[model samples]
Target: MTVRVSRVRQHSVWASLVSDDAQALRGWLLQLGFAEDLLIPGERVDAIHHCQLDWPEGGRILLSSTGERPTPCRPGTASLHVVTADPDAVLARATSLDARVVREIVDQTDYPSRDFTVADPDGNHWTFATFAG
Candidate 1:
């Protein structure tokens, strides 16, 4: 039987990021609760990993090569913006998982946003915040 594909239903985002070390980075992801990740066929720089804990809501990551030089994550390419009812609780979990504290949750006087940043195993940024300032 032949397989057919269509976009009428839905799709998930597979984000590609620059990585210098694949296994080391993936290990970090697993440690951060993204367990049982994987690397697809034919790759030299990095591997693709998945964390389906939230399934339809959470997305997977694709680790790509950056030659021999180190590269920072592409601005908006790899980010998971999550809205939480309790920002403090989320921040607690993130900090416990060794997430990078990009910004502390504070009352935004200008934009009405309260959020923080947490870096994943591969150093990809995942911002967990809410619009309620």
Candidate 2:
């Protein structure tokens, strides 16, 4: 069964990503606590035309496979910042997945937030922080 995003929470903006391996990217996002909202198949059995992953806290991301169609955006070149209540938990999950830690978690007194950065298998940098802004 496919999961649906909650109507209570509406998102006006969404981050978009292109992936060479859409399935693997989806798995990675799922492992990191993103819920699969939608997945549309492409021309090929294994190709994904589009996907929507909803973050537990808030917001959503749209992802598409790098296929025959030309896209201005390239895979592994996007950097996304996600705000979460628990960055430590996210860090632990990232470590369990053996994702590369691009930046160690640090407390920024100026911004008064805790954040860390990790690179997914596709090389996209994901930064999880306590500060929403």
Candidate 3:
């Protein structure tokens, strides 16, 4: 038996969040293996007006600094779940960054997923899971 994987060329939906310190958040995302796709600088050198970080597997995350503009989403209130082939590796990187562990790695037999959750410096919850669904 053989399995084939399909590549995703474009993503239709993206997760967006507001961060008190978008520059710092961008660095954190990079440490977690997200590639910087685009960055729009704000008035201040450290302020980020907008940024797009792409996950290697698929999908991307959009973020902007709080008070940079009026946004509906509030900072530190986002909960993002990302699917990855190697959750353990991602977890290790997150651990090295000293990110707060919200939930330890757990194997869910019913759904058949191995995942863990952590909190970014902005207090956003990020869950890395092997399950794509």
Candidate 4:
């Protein structure tokens, strides 16, 4: 089953980008109204709530983050989280595209979310999850 944004939004839904180039990445994200300070050089972002975006070329965007709840942009992030009712089906689709499954779908008793992870050809991380059923 194909998962949609609304499904994850039922609980706590959030997305972020952990990039190596936080400076250039932050600069690129700022153009779209992402918190420039949060992404600044040497900022203590580990615990802070920061918006992660894929928007480049600098444009206004609507993003969601704890710092800026209900962000100005839609639900879009460099790290993709796809909520699928049938995660196996979604995994098959990604596998067809040659996506690398880093983590197989399984129940995480410690965490509220049951999900798996994958890596795309570009090394972008994709997480597919669902609430424990």
Per-prediction tally of clashes: 0, 0, 0, 5
lDDT of 2 by residue, 2-35 (tens): 4444435345689888888988999999999999
Q: Is candidate 1 or 3 superior in lDDT?
A: 3
Q: After superposition, how far is residue 11 of candidate 1 from its true place, in Å?
A: 6.1
- Local error of candidate 2 at 26, Å? 0.4
Local accuracy by lDDT, each model: 0.55, 0.88, 0.89, 0.48
In candidate 1, the residue pairs with backbone N, CA or C atoms under 3 Å apart (3 or more residues apart, or in different chains) clash, namely none
Task: Give the TM-score ranking, best first.
Answer: 3, 2, 1, 4
User: Cα miss at 36, model 4 (Å)?
Assistant: 29
What would the per-residue lDDT of candidate 4 be over residues 1-133, giving only the tens digit for each residue? Answer: 4443442233244444444433443443343223432322233443223444432222222222323333333222356555555666666666766667788878767655677887644455667666523
lDDT of 1: 0.55
lDDT of 3 by residue, 1-133 (tens): 3434454344568999888889889999999999999999988778888899999999999988887878799989989889888999999999999999999998976775799999999999999998775
Q: For residues 13-93, what per-residue lDDT tens digits would candidate 1 score against the true structure?
A: 555565555556555555544545454423343433322233123455555444422456652346666555567777786
lDDT of 4: 0.48
Model 2 ranges off by over 4 Å: 1-11, 68-70
The most accurate candidate by lDDT is 3
Specify the poorest-scoring 10-residue window by lDDT in model 1. 48-57
User: Which one wins by TM-score: 2 or 3?
Assistant: 3
